[model samples]
Target: MTLALYSGNLLAQSHEWTNLHDEELRRRAVKAAGEKDLPALVSLTTAFLTVQGKSGVLTSPRTVEAYELGVRHFVEFATAQAVNILRPGRHDAQNYINTMLAAGRKPAGVHLKVAAASALYRALRWAGATEADPFREARVPKDPTPGIIKRPPYTEDELADVLDRADTHAKFLLFLTAHAGLRISEALNLHWDDIDEAAKRIHVRSGKGRKDRIVAMSTSLARAARHYRGLYAPGGPDHTDGKRTTPPENVFRYAEMTTARYHLSKAFKLAGVDFRGFHPGRKYAGTRLLRQIKDFGRVAAHLGHESVDTTRKGYASLAADDLKDDLAGW
Candidate 1:
């Protein structure tokens, strides 16, 4: 076993990853991965997954969490089989996939777990930890069912009710997505200077796809913004600090997406509405706006989508009730 070679390197650098800061872990991990530093790669991968450092990274928390969960299952399987997890054979990977499927895990879920296991082996190979990638050709069952149905956007009446029940900060967050079509991340990242009350427009900085866009606010959204600003940005968009007057760096009182999501769900419960998630509000904005304007490209731009096709596919599906009036003539 090449474990003999790794044992010597581990003696010197086994504790190195523990001493490094979370921010420094990723840079060192990349270097370790590239230079085939197996001991460093092992420690760094474990450490990086544990803290995940900070926000605004290329990968999202959701993806990281999913991968973590998947890897845990593989670790458990490896332990029971007495297999060298880092040097698993192709049959070991196949059995793991089969076990997950046999246990009634969804096909998609099994696939994701298999993919996570495959990713670990790829890292190991890159770090010269092992040449074996059992998961490389492992067969994962295809999902028999179509993708999960997404929750539909809220109706205008339902959104209005939610707004009425929400307080200051929640109202602004909801309005940003429900009316202005800002993504939850974009909304949370907003600053007072990004809003233009006079022009009824918002400057979304570094939205999805790392693109900046200008979005027009609906009349109702503008009203909500004014009310929110009156309470939160009471400094009138300019605070005199020493000699300079600067807008607040962030518009919302809450900095984290989880905080914003919690408040939105609370408001939904209070309003007696089913709590679906933030995207519904954005879908409402795009779908309603497209209904009024009947223009795909215009609505896509308003939603900060780079392609009109995305806007059309996501927001253009119409229910039978929506077409009742138009079809009545036939």
Candidate 2:
């Protein structure tokens, strides 16, 4: 009777003493945080992000968001094999790293996943749920050189087909990405005042890495922008609540990236072309400009790259075989 009472007391007390049955590392991760499940984990993540922001360790919401994304991605990868979140060893870390590497993702992309995995480890430790740091022995993967065969840029014809079929707002947004080589965020964040139709240049304020640049517009892009601007003049979709509004402040202000993705996909379906995600639009632009300009330095300047090497390595860099045709001419 005394032994039974003791056992009951142990069961009722802190769960850490008991060998808990965790399903696929999910329970272990939550329980390690002294949490019940995913909700608790999310709550812990939010709390951690808030603390990080307040402490100035990570002041930007965008940075915190990136961390959160990394956390979720890591959790998905690590929990696949179901390790003890509280007692995860080096093997678990290696598994995640290996799995990510094996997936053939670009090194830059894999680096984000690895950093995110590390962030989750930090969160767990900071939450006082577990002192375990599974990623302690984690190693970063190696980045590979860029080649033409790698991540084949979408063709101009594909872009044209999709552009012709897109809705009014989508056309302007996609035009910037496809022709101007603006990132999706850059295109969306554009203001009407930033457009210089006479100059034929689109000012990309705060592009990737917070760098700003101007992208010259194509004839088609200029025409599309003029058409969209014409709509902005009267009671158009951009100016629905027209109450003394001079012009729409942000060009694609009402357009959401998610909605744009949907529209792009729909347009591709209608055009009978395969649709990759929007970044391919940037790739298409870069490759086209590189070929037309035939100079990596010039292409880099046009694309607003901080370095010519980046332009050469990413957009204009051709594989050894791809340069064979030019070699014959040489």
Candidate 3:
């Protein structure tokens, strides 16, 4: 007979987790147990499940799997260093960094691993497991991975050419993402309820770090959305019976990342634009908005950045031309 340990009431005192049903509890347990013998894994997993669940992102299976994998990697590193299962230290973190280097992990991959481990340490600390955060002392190598290089902004003529070549729905999605500075995930996850035609704004309920903000929609974007809506709406003889009415809660699911890549690759080759994908479009939008818009705060709000500094860092390159023009005038 196998004895099953009941891990109940761990969250009984916490109002946030107390109301969680059976399915949520089981999911949390499974995620926590993914790692081998990180003594506080169970508690850390519970914390993640609670926090992310409240943030409305815990429903994404992919996100949960990524968390589990990250936890597993940390556990493996901790075990190799003979770190105390419940009380890891700075030396353990150092050893893990050396081991990762020895295994030929790239700087970015190592950074992610270290960051993930740090998150786990923080989680464990939150759960009353230990006082030390070994990751605080875990030094990332001197040569940190370079940030992603911003691609050149698309010229107005090039943009027109790409739009003309793209399919109708693809064009609209591309325009929204590139012109509006929406992330691919945010743009793809948009629903009809989020759009306010009269207000000329779209509420981005989900953003990076689970923050919410509203972005003003361009007239072109609003028009395209209305057109897309009409295309998806049921009408004519097809809806005579009235039973096949389109659902009010519909969202456009065109051009997923992989599909977008395939189609955009073909479009790029045909247009000879040397552009790759939608991310460049976002960069273009950000750069253009920063350069053309007089107010940094408004630009930051439109792009849903926490601060103007983030906007500056992302869009500073766009100012080079303005600087050149000023020098010429001087």
What TM-score goes with each of the models?
Answer: 0.67, 0.72, 0.65
Worst 10 residues of 2 by lDDT: 1-10
Judge candidate 3 against the unseen true structure and give its global Cα lDDT, from 0 to 1: 0.61
For model 3, residues 19-63, the per-residue Cα lDDT tens digits are: 557456444434443334443463455455555444432334334
- As a TM-score, model 1 comes out at 0.67
Task: Show where candidate 3 strays beyond 4 Å.
Answer: 1-46, 49-66, 76-89, 98-111, 126-132, 141-162, 196-200, 209-212, 233-248, 254-278, 327-329
lDDT by residue (64-157, candidate 1, tens digit) is 5455555556666776777666555658888888888888887767888886666556544534445777876778766544231344778888
Error at 109, model 1, angstroms = 6.2
Candidate 3 collision pairs: none
Choose 2 or 3, whichever is better by TM-score.
2
Candidate with the greatest lDDT versus the true structure: 1
Candidate 2 yields a Cα-based lDDT of 0.65
Looking at model 2, the pairs that clash are: none
lDDT by residue (164-229, candidate 2, tens digit) is 788876788778877887777677678888888878998888576567788899998899889988
> Which runs in model 2 stand beyond 4 Å of their true positions?
1-66, 76-82, 100-109, 124-133, 140-148, 233-238, 241-248, 253-255, 307-309, 318-330
Q: Which ranges of candidate 1 are over 4 A from the true structure?
A: 1-84, 89-118, 132-149, 234-248, 306-316, 320-330
**Candidate 1 to native Cα RMSD, angstroms:** 8.7
